[model samples]
Target: MRIFRKITTPSNYHHHQLRSYVSTCRAVVLPSFGGADKLQLRSDVPVPPLKPNHVLVRTRAVSVNPLDTRMRSGYGRSIFEPLLPLILGRDVSGEVAAVGESVRSVIVGQEVFGALHPTAVRGTYTDYAILSDDEVTPKPTSLSHVEASAIPFAALTAWRALKSTARISEGQRILIVGGGGAVGFAAIQIAVAAGCNVATTCGSQSVDRILAVGAEQAVDYVAEDVELAIKGKFDAVLDTIGVPETERMGINFLKRGGHYMTLQGEAASLTDRFGLAIGLPAATTFLLKRQIQYRYSHGIEYSWTFMRADIEGLIEIRKLCEAGKMKIPVDKTFPITQVKEAHEAKDNKLIPGKVVLELD
Candidate 1:
């Protein structure tokens, strides 16, 4: 790999300018598609040159997401296989080490936290990770790097579903199919912040946490009939568990002209199985058909939502975090050297909540 602007010592980060920056840094690379053992922590991974709108973050903490584990197991092989040796992380919290020439919104030496797109190749699991300008914003002073790292990816996902896709307005009723998980929990809070009455389904253990975060109703899915427990129809339903049965139930719970969105879209799976050429169009057709069918039969909108980098949403999420209103509890933390162990825990479900990787 080509290297440039090499520095032998850590440059002063208290200033707002980066005259020189490190060209190589520590990163966890997935050299091949497989289990956690395939993850290699190398100290000399090359850092790509920043684009005009890019910001280089000196990584402090990154979270292990479900997509990272799935990607390790060859989940997005069609798109990622050829791009082997990919860094596998989405959420990041750290200081701005450098900025591209055209950047102005955020300056060097400022603390920031944000998440990358799910399909990004150059991920955040590095000593220095590249994120687009809008993909990151000022970190909330109320949260640490680890705590800030946990919120963006999960919260942005819920934001995309509730705010972007559903366009939920105040005083509306929202139903979240699975509220125990990070995305579901964040959805509950986002909906409540928007003045929507929130109802959710989860295991009994998560009931308290769900309610603590402003959910009006929490039904234990294992012990109760969801339809009977959730009394009224909803303006929108965000189904984190996209199983056919849950999809049907969520659809039924929505009022006419309401929206139903799911996190598990078949776009990636179809493309992985059928190859991109055939799979891309196939997935589009399938999604269109489902949307049409649901719209015609139930008079509602159906969509597949994914986490995206939204500056406005990210800023609002930061504000919520500043006010102690949004957060995802970190279950366990591992040093960057223990990335393999982190992935293993996530794969075996040993750590049910968020898992983070810290870099010194």
Candidate 2:
């Protein structure tokens, strides 16, 4: 069901600004990795200069993800420490303000949305941001900037897990864990649209919502044992909640030769928990060992998914959204200045879908 049908251009759409005029922009910056208090609103941040094959976008809205919270808390301090005072957002929807010398896929004044690669120094939590042309596409005509901003990261994760990793085919049976969350919500729709029999597990409050998104069955994981509730076998199990027990249950739900995928992978290791020096390597080895062990025991493939930005995949998602086959579920919208409150809301599980930040 398409909740939003009337497609319109972003309200802030404007003509191109000359690249020669460099200016400062406002952004939410993480000065140091810690808690929500570390997320500071700074107005003097300078927007990056236009580079070849890139486009400068006047940010309209940005979506908050678990990754943003993790990054703010220094979850990957070992890798991201050198990039302190970083902007922490990925999904963005805005109007192109200027284009680089060689950019061709998009033009100034075009409304676009994309998930910025996580490695980028500048992220979407700003008044202006630059993105490589190949990483973005025209915003779906069926959604507004606020709604479009909520989509890219979660949708791309679902797309990669189902399309790239699972290679889901028509009539296949797929079980998606954590169907109440954004990624799981998107996975249900993408799988259902692909002609698969989709079953999902969520809270009792989320059952109706998950089913409304075309899930054939919605099991309340809080009330019942998921492994016992889902009957028969699934062709693939996509687990958005990365936990060892859940992963084991997912493997049990899968049929012989089926695939099981999780989002966390080895990042959630005991070594990391104990603050050991071998945390990273130990976690990687643990994941590898599990993958081999599962393959031999159950004749099922096991893999972890770390979602990446892919233009082709985003384009397919755009089509699905425009055609009313998929919908971006936004739970709440907050001004960029209220980023701390937004993060707290998401961390506290106060929203069913995405918590977005609207930029001026």
Question: Each model's TM-score, in the order given?
Answer: 0.95, 0.90
Q: Model 2, 1-360: lDDT tens per residue?
A: 111122223334442333333367788998898778889999878775566778878899999988898878877766667778799999899998777767778887899999887667688999888889877899998899999998888999999999999899999999999998888988999999899999999989789888887899999988997777788999999999978788888999899889999988766444446445777678878878988999899989998887687888999999999988777678789999999999988777787578899987
In model 1, the clashing pairs are none
TM-score computed on alpha carbons, candidate 2:
0.90
lDDT of 1: 0.91
What candidate 1 gets wrong by more than 4 Å, as runs, is 1-18
The top-ranked prediction according to lDDT is 1
Tens digits of per-residue lDDT, candidate 1, 115-215, equal 99998998999999999999999999999999999989999999999999899999999999989898998899889899999999999889999999899
Candidate 2 lowest-lDDT run of ten: 1-10
